[model samples]
Target: MSRVYLSLGSNINPKHNIREGIATLNLRFGQMQLSPIIESEPVGFIGDPFINLITTLETELPISELSSQLRLIEYDFGREDNAPKFSGRTLDIDIVLVDQLEGEHFGLTLPRKDLFEHGYMLYPLSLMEPELIPPGQEKTVQELWQQFPFPEQKLWLTEL
Candidate 1:
């Protein structure tokens, strides 16, 4: 089995959608390691705040098939294929890392670029796997979190 990390976020009906998303993932993947749910301001567009979190699961499926399944899950939750990149979403799921695999596989970038650029991605990942060294990177997740610029983008754990 390959260990896969995924980032999930939702702005529209976030509390409900996020919970539903997780439940769906759990049903499909059997079990998952979930980070604390957090709330953050929308990054690229004007919209409601988003509830975000990261999850890790073990899967026997290949990256291509896994990515395809995730997209289908997002669609089932009302994600629009043509929606603007920065717009609000019902559910947004991205493959952040898949074991030690690197570069692009199935058109998806491993160790997603957002992991370095967004606190929403890095913080939760660090929480889940502090010692994890992403593919092609020497720094551990904890190191990246420590180096993250504070006060740049605000995010807080949510009770929801």
Candidate 2:
């Protein structure tokens, strides 16, 4: 089984969506390691705050199949394909890392760029898997997080 890490976020009805999203993932992938939910302002657009978290699961499925499954989950929760790139979301789930594999798999980049670009993504990941070494990177997630400008991005842990 490959260890897969995913990032989930929601702005609209975040509490409900996040709970349902987690439940769905658990049902599909069995038990998962979850990070504390964190609330952060939307990036690249003006919208409501988003609740974000990272989850780790073990799956035997290939990246293509796993990605397809996640898209279905987001769609079931009311995600719109036509929505603007940085617009509000009912539920957003993205693959972050799949083991220590690098390069493109299933047409998606391993170790997503957002892993380092956004505090909302990096912080929760570091909390869950501090020693995780992202693909093609030498530093652990915790180490990268240490250099993150937390103050520059407004985010706080939520009670979800």
Candidate 3:
């Protein structure tokens, strides 16, 4: 089985969406390792604040199939494919890292760029998989997280 790390977030009915989303992922992917959920102000859009976290699961599906599966879950919770990139979401799930594979696969950059850009994503990732080394990175997630400029952003630990 391939180990996969995913970032999950929601702003629209965030608490309900996040809990249900976690249940669904657990059912579909078997056991999962979860980080502490975080509540944060939305990025690049004016809307309700979002709750975000990282989860690690083991799956036999390839990258494309895993992406497709996650999309299906998002769709079930009202995600619209045509929605603006920065719009509020019922649920948003993205692959952060899958095994050690690098480069573009199914149009996704390995270790999605948002993983590096967002404190909400990176902090939880570091909590869940502190030792992870994404492709092209010489430092572990924990190490990179230490250097991240998070003071410019606001994120709070939240309970689901």
Q: What are the Cα lDDT values of the candidates?
A: 0.90, 0.92, 0.91
The TM-score of candidate 3 is 0.95
Best by lDDT: 2
- Tell me the RMSD of model 3 versus the true structure: 1.1
Residues 1-160 of candidate 2 have per-residue lDDT tens digits of: 9999899999999999999999999999999999988999999998899999999999999899999999999999998878889999999999999988888887998789888899999999888889988888889999999988656788989967
Q: Which ten residues in a row have the lowest lDDT in candidate 3?
A: 149-158
Give candidate 1 misplaced runs (Cα > 4 Å): none
The TM-score, computed over Cα atoms with residue i paired to residue i, of candidate 2 is 0.96
lDDT tens string, model 1, 61-118?
9998999999999999998889999899999999999988888887988779998999
lDDT of 3 by residue, 19-42 (tens): 999999999988789998899999
Global Cα lDDT for candidate 3: 0.91
Clashing pairs in 3: none
Off by over 4 Å in 3: none
Between the candidate structures 2 and 3, which one is better when assessed by TM-score? 2
- Per-residue lDDT of 65 in model 2: 96
- Cα-based RMSD of the predictions, in order? 1.1, 1.1, 1.1
lDDT for predicted candidate 2 compared with the true structure: 0.92
